[model samples]
Target: MGMQTTPMIEMDFAVIKEDFSRYLIHDGAILKVKIVVKKILRTAELTAQGYPAGTSIDSVNAVAAIVPQALKREPSKEPWDPRRDVGEEVKFEPQEEKWQEYMTTEGYRILIKPVLTKVFRYNKYNDYGEPIYSAVIQSITNIEKLGTTATT
Candidate 1:
């Protein structure tokens, strides 16, 4: 299905300035400069990417472009942290000693204790003829839950 599009609303800045001045000021067409700036900022923010075909150009477009430009020019990621995340999945093959230790460790008690099932799948033989038991552990945390929080 195609995305839905909305027709843009045309605005007259001269009428906006007159109405704002009338509503706010008792003497003259004078609004607090900050308030005027904020109104312009909010209108541009909300109406951004909605300026349809035949929409008259104004300083609002210049204001709107600033947001995307600032986003694009955000400081690049640190060289050391390429992935920006350390969450790695739990794979059972090539299981180290700590892997089996964590299976029954107090840290994972809630997940391991609730299901209380550990079914092993023999994937392949190791170099020294030792069997590789890919332990299909029944735990919700096995996928992306590591290093987030400890059950214990």
Candidate 2:
């Protein structure tokens, strides 16, 4: 007869910042300012990847139990904390742009860009061997700046 092993659970969360701001400077002077306003969303999920068929409800509950704690554990608030963040991925997109007479008076136009960044760290290790190695399947999303502000 074959032996059965307890299913393993993996949990992770994403940090979403819909609103943020940055600065735009020209000739050491402020031109215009941009403000971002959105909801901050944080989400998490738990799963047992290799669980066999007919898995008991209790097993699922057990896995879900850790979600609360995981959700509460927000990735380090410090955006560049080396201890927690290993690397980063950045994406920039022009969401909208407008050139108004009022804005032109300020000597610059208002440009709003959506910036999405993903921060992550290696969680799984290959083995305790000479050269340590790790891998990651899903990464945590970190929203930092939503908009830019500059004065002229």
Candidate 3:
């Protein structure tokens, strides 16, 4: 993939009342900009249909809709355990050709670690009565956060 380049964006807004300068910044070339939004969502109508109560809220639980549901995990023997450590990894006849081919087939960049870690919860009511866990992937989006900076 090619490297990414920054873009020049123009922001236009009207003055609601006053305090206009704080919203805009005049610079040499507008090198960097950080937007501080009052809120992502605009207020719904002050009134609903009849007596105009006020813009109370559009949503009850914000995080409930966005935050991913916790993934369940089934218990399993981990690949690596300190207690079960095999006395120092014994060297075997190196598969040089196969090793090189594997590395080439799957580039290092494609083997990066996962962004989110898995959570495991133990349960003791299965057939054998040991511990078991079930897990699944979850997506993260729609987060409220500070704006980012730009470089030009």
Using lDDT as the measure, the top candidate is 2
List candidate 2 stretches off by more than 4 Å: 1-70, 74-80, 83-108, 121-152
Candidate 3: C-alpha lDDT: 0.20
RMSD of each: 30.0, 22.9, 25.3
Score candidate 2 by lDDT. 0.24
Task: List lDDT for all candidates, in order.
Answer: 0.22, 0.24, 0.20
Q: Name the candidate, 2 or 3, with the larger TM-score value.
A: 2
What is candidate 2's TM-score against the reference?
0.19
Compared with the true structure, what per-residue lDDT tens digits does model 1 show for residues 1-152?
Answer: 99965544433322112111111111111111111111111122232323222322222100000111211222323322323423222222211111111211212211111111222313233333322222122222121122534365
Q: Which order, best to worst by lDDT?
A: 2, 1, 3
Query: Measured by TM-score, how close is model 3 to the native structure?
Result: 0.16
lDDT for each residue of candidate 2 in 57-136, tens digit (9 for 90 to 100): 11100000111222233333233434554543222232322211112121222222322232122222212211111112
Better of 2 and 3 by lDDT: 2
Each model's backbone clash number: 0, 7, 10
Which ten contiguous residues of candidate 2 have the minimum total lDDT? 57-66
| Residue ranges of candidate 3 with Cα displaced over 4 Å | 1-102, 105-109, 115-128, 137-152
